[model samples]
Target: MDVLAVEVLRIPMAVDLAAIVIGALTGGLLAAREGFAVSGVLLLAVSGGLGGGLIRDVLLDVPVVALTNPVYLPTVGITAMVTFFFSGWLSRTTGLLVGLDALTLGFFTVIGAQKAQLAGLPVTSVVFIGVATAVGGAVIRDVLLAQRADIVQPGPYNAVAALIGASLLAVLAGPLELPLLPVAAVVIALTAGLRLVSVLRGWSAPVAID
Candidate 1:
């Protein structure tokens, strides 16, 4: 129960590293589809997996754990290797990765909000960081692949779900002052539920008129 900030909850390092693996899974799948070599897979994995935290730390002006931590790079590397090998099977197993992405969405969100809380940011900024942490990696992946950021275009409720999760955390952790683990649980469940339902029901964010 090592605390990082006054009254702010610090999630376990294992959980934090797990989010990186899940995010990198998405990148690894994409690289496999493109027939990239092992090195390229590792690159996209780092970008898609670790980029968000990098962005968050930079904004916070704190040390970058992705680069600094001894365990982080290896975690991403192993994930990329596994994903590259299993890309075929994983692609065939429809909804598996999607479910994982949905499930872990809250992890990144809560961690981002937690970091912002450590920095004493206001609620709005906290929510912003949360969503950024959840989806910033994907945006970087798309950019590196020479495509548009899927989030900017019409898509499902990925960011919206993250927003809801981060906002809930802001409310519970800010005004209500609830316990950290319970609040994080609620946020994660709600965000994942929203995302999963949206995907299953084919819900998409509204776009401008044609």
Candidate 2:
């Protein structure tokens, strides 16, 4: 593992674990809706849970955390299995899905920015990597399902929320010398707030007319 990978491994386990479970649940539910079998559901869940971090790690030229960490892949598998078995009960809770998605978005976005900053990437690269980490799994899931990538298409401020948080973190923690934990908390709150509000308000980027 590279230095960057080692740094990522030291991140707070709570944040990483929460994000993984939420991401896995989101993917598993989508797979169930798509009528996938157990294997396909597990596949999608793991992809969704780990895909963003893996992409970010690759971009940073670091070892993939999920691949190297025994805990991560197992967490993904267990979350997927639980989501699969309880999907019927979970299906009724749209609010739960929305909340989990927003939480996962926040956690991943902040972690990505933190990791990229530690890797000594430029501010622009850090922000981009943060957004990529926030949505990479969903992008992979959409591609696998042959659907339009929500992050790229017109959507409810998904990547925009990530951009807001990542840019703020890059500014606050990079030059302002703010403490990391407080910055992370604020970033997560902002990202989750933006996402949830956008969903509730039906906010979207302006459409282009040719």
Candidate 3:
């Protein structure tokens, strides 16, 4: 692989790890609030934390992290333990969980875009992969819990925020040739901030009132 490809791969792995951590924490809190047992919490943590990456990798024809990487297992395990140990503290602050979820969404979106670019996918395809990466886990989680997926629901532009972030990364990658870490950080920050603002302000996509 070329130097740029090597650099892209390394940074996205780090970002994926960070996303897993955030997902595990958020999933743990949700599971605790739902009165899940320790096993259930751990299950949710693993599923929610790594589900998207699994889907993304499979779609991209790469090895799935949950099956191939030891790091993913321990990361989710640690997150579950921390949440179980501090259940009381986290159960009281639901907002923090939502914020972390948003951050994870942003992180995964960028990773998907970066990976798509490395895989030689078109820009539009890369953007689609990014959206799938950001929302796939939540979709799986909700299905397991028998709840609606937030990304598809009429909420404050969750998937749209991810699309924007992925597009930004792809655009930046094309011209400026910014390093993956800095580009990923900027994309994640902007996307998360946009989602937070939308949540706070009750923003939503326009609807026709025929």
Candidate 4:
């Protein structure tokens, strides 16, 4: 591969790993809350860590890197172990889980959009792909835990935040001629910031009245 292609691939991997670590931490905490065993915690961690990327790759018709590469598994595994052992500390660290989860949402959103752009998908499709990647893991996690998916739930504008961020990045990168790195930074910041504000301010979509 050429230098630019290699760089693109390398950058995604960094964002993917960051998302994985944060997702694993959140999954570990959830498993602990449910009184899950070590094995269960690890399983949940892997699901949350790699699930969204798997969905994104599948949608893009690309090889799932988590399956093909050794690094992803080990990185998530170590993160899960640390999270499992330090559950108490993590729990005590107020806002840590929420912050990490929001950041992960942003990372996945950007990853999905960039991949779709590289695939030469249309702008609308890129936005949808970004939203899908952002929410796929949470949907899986919710199913496993027997809880409502965040995207469907009535609070905090989880997927909406991702959509806004992803759409913003798509516009900036596609039309405004911004570099991918700066585009990604703005997307992550906006996505995470929106989520944080929503949570703190109790923002939610309007409910249908009977």
Q: Which candidate is the best by TM-score?
A: 2
Indicate whether candidate 1 or candidate 2 has the larger lDDT: 2
**Candidate 3: where is the Cα deviation over 4 Å?**
1-5, 12-15, 175-181, 208-210
lDDT of each: 0.85, 0.89, 0.82, 0.83
Clash pairs detected, candidate 2: none
Q: Write candidate 1's Cα lDDT for 30-81 as tens digits.
A: 8998999888899889977798888888887888878878888889999999
In candidate 4, the residue pairs with backbone N, CA or C atoms under 3 Å apart (3 or more residues apart, or in different chains) clash, namely: none
> Residues 136-179, candidate 4, lDDT per residue (tens digit)?
87888888878877678688878899889989988999878788
Q: List where candidate 2 sits over 4 angstroms from the true fold.
A: 1-11
Model 2, 1-210: lDDT tens per residue? Answer: 377556666557887898898898889988988889999899899878999999999998987888988899999999888878888888889798898899889999988998889988888888999999999999889888888998777869899999999999998988887988888899999999999999999999667899
RMSD of 1: 2.3
Query: Whole-model lDDT for model 2 versus the true structure?
Result: 0.89
**Model 3, position 147: C-alpha lDDT score:** 88
| Candidate 4 lDDT for residue 145 | 79
**Considering lDDT, where higher is better, how would the candidates rank from best to worst?**
2, 1, 4, 3
Q: Name the regions of candidate 4 deviating beyond 4 angstroms.
A: 1-7, 10-15, 208-210
lDDT per residue, candidate 3, 1-210, as tens digits? 476446556765776687898888877778887999999889788777887777888998877757877788998999999998898987787787778778888888887787778888888888988888888877777888998777667779788899899989988885567777788889989999988889889999556589
